[model samples]
Target: MGRKNISDQRRGEIIISFYEVSRSLGLENASIAKLAQHMGISKGLVLHYFKNREELLLGLNEYILEQHLRVMVSEDIGKMDCKEHVIHFIENLFTRAWNTYFDDGVFYSCYALVYRVPEFKESFKAYLIQLHEVLYKKLEEAVAFDVIVATDLKELTEVIFALIDGAYYYLGMYNEHDLAYKQQIAIYVKYSLRLLDFRS
Candidate 1:
């Protein structure tokens, strides 16, 4: 049991190093040998954990999902009530907070793999579905607490994520300081609040 735990920890460490390297270098350039050097370990050791770049990317997809959860949802949202939670949730999704956790280039590179490999496609879908599930739960809570109206929670969750996906992809082209970036956030938030029937 102890050995299994250690193995999982080691595998997670290697995946994190892979994410960092992929951020600096392109994902295609982030090879296993490169990850080994980045960790100051050996290629053979890295291989022991990840058989190849394909498997390592599968691990990276999991890492991206974990980071997205941190950005999109929260446990108690740092003691915030449901209303504060809704606003923070919306603002965080549109802001640069994700930059602190994962790189856009590294993330999208992994996303592109969804088109190439079946297993990779499933992992990527898991990433999206995981986010959707958590957000749906949060929306349910907001309705329970009267923070939002009791509409079709599932449908509203889907619409919100669709808006979020579109906002991020388009806003990625603009600098965070650009007026266009701020405007997009405002525009999306306004409609999202309307959907939730948010008064504040």
Candidate 2:
């Protein structure tokens, strides 16, 4: 692997290929050789853009975060009603697309690495904090519009994130066929709405 400049498109291709290979091969087992082969690029080229596995993983994490924001938060926050915005946030978190976007194995591998690697720990922690901030902002908007009556923004933000994370983890552990999965998600959504004191 030599130092060479790569186009942003090439870098994105490598990141995506890394994700595809890692998902199939398991992140720990997915070697740079496999990633290079998957992308049909030379190993040196992969290294040219990402100096090492740690750098690649961090880049992948950033890519995942950006993709999530694009897909899950497409609507302008100021344009939607408070209730609609709140529902949007919940639906995106529990949706099948969300599961696909963060494939169970790859997502958990990243999660586990956060605890073991100090550098990854900070990057992953920042990602979670950003997620909380986004949710908190939406909740604040909801309160302003009287969508949830009155609420404690900080406490409610923690509760909401916990509920979503718990349900997502539960569903991942017991991933079933589409029908059963949908049923479970429906139940989760209902319960989450109840927590927000949300009414039709």
In order of appearance, the predictions have TM-scores of: 0.93, 0.82
Report the lDDT tens digits of candidate 2 across residue range 61-157: 8766776655456554343256777776777677656654667788888889988889988988888888888777777667767787667778888
How high is the CA lDDT of each candidate model? Answer: 0.85, 0.77
- Residue-level lDDT tens digits of model 1 in 61-121: 9998899898776553642246877887777777788888889999889888888999999
Lowest summed lDDT across 10 adjacent residues in model 1 is found at: 73-82
Global local distance difference test of model 1: 0.85
Which candidate number would show the highest TM-score if scored against the true structure?
1
Model 2, residue 59: C-alpha shift (Å): 1.1
